[model samples]
Target: DAYGAIRANQGLYLSSWGQLGASGDQLDLTPARQQLDSAYHLSDSLSQSAQDHNADALDSRQNLKQAGDDADDRYGNSEQLSDADQSNARGATDSGGRGEAARMKAPWLHLASPAGITLSTPESTHLAQGRSLSISSGEDVNIATGKSLVASISEKLSLFVQKAGIKLFAARGKVEMQAQDGEMAFTAEKGVKVTSTEGRIEINAENGILLQSGGGYIRIEGGNIEVHCPGAADLKGAQHNFGGPTSLTRTQPEL
Candidate 1:
């Protein structure tokens, strides 16, 4: 009954009032409204999804840049440490070699060799051998041998010869000789003589000095002072002074 009433009303109103409306095309608007609503909803959803994807891509790029910066800092620190270690190792090796050379050149130790020995030193040296001996030094020298000996010195040397004999090859300094129970001979550029001894002493010098012989006679041909005695006598020779008393005098020379 309600549907029949609405249809009868719609037909009466449309016949009277519908003629008063504008036109047929203006009145038909249902299809256009449905199409416009569908297009607007689809466009809004697509725009929202695109914005979320762009935000995720930006976050990923920032993370990668931060990781690259951290790795570079670690590499720079490692290189500095490696260079420091190498420099320390080289310095230790050079210092050790210099220490060894210093110990070898000390003057305290006594050096000896056969077939005539050659020596250089800043201090004194002592040589004792039965064969012919030769010595050289910057300081003093003392030679006591059973046979002939030759000595050279840049400084002062105190020489003692046994019953055999001695020949002073060269001397740049003073020479003092003691021939005990033996005959000793020496030559010098400056001065040479004998002090006190039980044997005979012969000295030849250019500068000239005092020479004396005790139980043994000290003979100096061209020295400053020359003396000959039977017992032990004080002999001042070159740059040396001798002192002592004489013993028994023997007619036959000991050496």
Candidate 2:
């Protein structure tokens, strides 16, 4: 031990120190060493006890919550079963009309916790019978699954992100955006710009493309040659300016 020296000649040895060690040889440190070991052992035992107590408390809380939820579900179902039995007796005496309705009044199975309801593996979960899946959150909700994510809306779907923006990235497959009604609208605070890195950029409008300015009327500036049309061209507006002819300007189209 660093705290003491050992005198050894046989199996039985005594621990002491030279007269010039940290604590002088006249100063016995065996009691101090034993006191330190005892203190450390006591501290470790207390820490372990506290940790075990905390773990047990957490497990007990979880089990209590689960038991309460199960009791609620059972109570609900039992109440419904009592009502159904009465209905069945009444229909058996009356005409056959109410008998069919009694059989249809079966209770749905549901188990809910304070957090949320979870349908276990054997239980199948259906949302509004294919109507819509809506969620309202106070803070944030995250979903992680090992399967696919599909959002199919019949009528209209709207998303509004107030604080941060939304970004969509496709790693492998294509990104397809289609409006069956052929009317799509996008508005941004600054502006909307679309770019392509590798492939060509194509814009197709069944009718035609329209560019209009709200504040100022219109302004067209080209660093080199801006406008290009293959077929026919027409300029019909309140005011039109055919800029000075340069190599890039061709007011006429080929036949």
Candidate 3:
């Protein structure tokens, strides 16, 4: 018949109009304290479970392999993965807000985020699989930084594919490709052009040459050009401006 309001820090409390009978530590004591303690531990158990799922996804750093290859990782096996292994993969990726496809994409650096992750080592990171690598997007995907982007590939196979394209530009420096002791070939379906404003250009081939463009078998343009043809040459045009050595041997048009 005295209190008009009530306050609490550990458990619930209520007071109004002289009829205060609430199950709280401030009103009752032992039963409310025991109930609140149990509830707090129950929440702790659930939080621990969610952390385990996150750990399962990223707790993997195994030897990654592909079809038809030798072993790089000594501890991990080279045989096929089991069904349980695949299910664990799904749980691991989905914990990080990703699908199971993220498992297949980790060998290469498929990092996409704002903060980003770092891979630092003294050795190299190798992608030794015989399969192809694919990067796709529904919209424009940009890779940018405050520094330069450098890629060094040690081997060269057939490097182009039809219906797919890649464009690269350097704002300050030159874009250079060097094949050590081999030749470089550039082919276009429509046309090919080599132009320079303040520098000279040169093309040298040890074997024969075949150029197909502009209704002609061979077209050359230079300030003071030098062409050496030994076997045979074909020129198809109404008018051609060709200047060669006067002792040019065995020159015949195969028209």
lDDT tens digits, residue span 1-255, model 2: 459754423212123323343322221223333433444444344445545543221122333233223322111111222223323333323433222221111222222223344446765556564332223344577987677888786555434444366888989988877665466777767978898889899654333444555432332354332344544456789987888866433343222
Better of 2 and 3 by lDDT: 2
Candidate 2 Cα lDDT to native = 0.40
Which scores better on lDDT, 1 or 2? 2
After superposition, the stretches of candidate 1 with alpha carbons farther than 4 Å from their true spots are 1-25, 55-255
Model 2's TM-score against the true structure: 0.36
Worst 10 residues of 2 by lDDT: 71-80
| Candidate 1 positional error at 202, Å | 99
Off by over 4 Å in 2: 1-118, 122-124, 127-134, 213-255
Candidate 1: worst 10 consecutive residues by lDDT?
97-106
TM values, all candidates: 0.12, 0.36, 0.30
Overall lDDT per candidate, in order of appearance: 0.35, 0.40, 0.38
What's model 1's lDDT at 222?
40
Error of 3 at 174 (Å): 2.4
Q: State each candidate's clash count.
A: 14, 0, 1
Query: Model 1 over residues 1-255: C-alpha lDDT tens digits?
Result: 455433221111111223224433221222322333343343344335545544111223333232223222110111223223322222223343111111111111222222333567877677775533332232345867675567576534433332345665444544545654545654566766556555666533333445343455445334223555665556476787567743332253333
Q: Top TM-score: which candidate number?
A: 2
